[model samples]
Target: MTINIVVGAAIIRDGRLLAAQRAEPAELAGGWEFPGGKVDSGESDEDALVRECHEELGVKVALGDRVGGDWPLSAGSVLRVWTAGLVEGEPRALEHLELRWLGRDELGTVGWLPGDLPVVEAIAAYLG
Candidate 1:
């Protein structure tokens, strides 16, 4: 089986966590997620995270550490998450419908994509 590795970033600034709403791929539209994308071959997770953040959110980020355990995605893929800090540029909704910063108490209030739940929980704990 072919396995694909995807990465996600839990970008936090000033006590708020950034969440993005999906805008494409009919099935995932309107759902919330941490901004990131697939890890290219020969790329480190940190490099992938930074590239994805720039591509999807138009921001530069510094990856801190892993946020949660691996999550299985469709098509034999696994999603890995990390905690990130904004290093340059403000995050913009480049590929998403919307972007919002949620406080720790409001983390669970949004409709997160199913695969992102574990990372979300881990982020909540990290913030507390």
Candidate 2:
């Protein structure tokens, strides 16, 4: 099976992390996630994170360090996460149901997608 690499962005500002609510793919609907998407062929993870944030959140983000190691996704795909800072424009829910900023104390309150849980933990640890 071919492996697809997906990138997720943990965009932080004012000591809060941006969380997006998924609105599609029925199964993932209403699940919270860091804004990002699949990396295209020949595209670097950083490039893909930037592109995905633009496409999904209507914002430009400056990427920071990688978060946790790769987490597995359905269909032979792996999900990788990175920390990011907003560089231009505010994040709008261009593709999601809603967007919320969660403080380190509130991170555990949202219903994160299963594939995102590990990344969430990593972010929580990084923020502490």
Tens digits of per-residue lDDT for model 1 on 1-128?
87888999999898899999999899999999999999898999789989999999888898888866678778689999888999999999989999999999999889999888777877886674
Candidate 2 segments whose C-alpha is farther than 4 A from its true place: none
lDDT of 2 by residue, 1-128 (tens): 68899999999998899999999999899999989998999999899999999999888899999986889878789999988999999999999999999999999899999889878888986664
Task: Give lDDT per model, in order.
Answer: 0.90, 0.91
In model 1, state the lDDT of residue 10.
92
Clashing pairs in 2: none
TM-score of decoy 1: 0.94
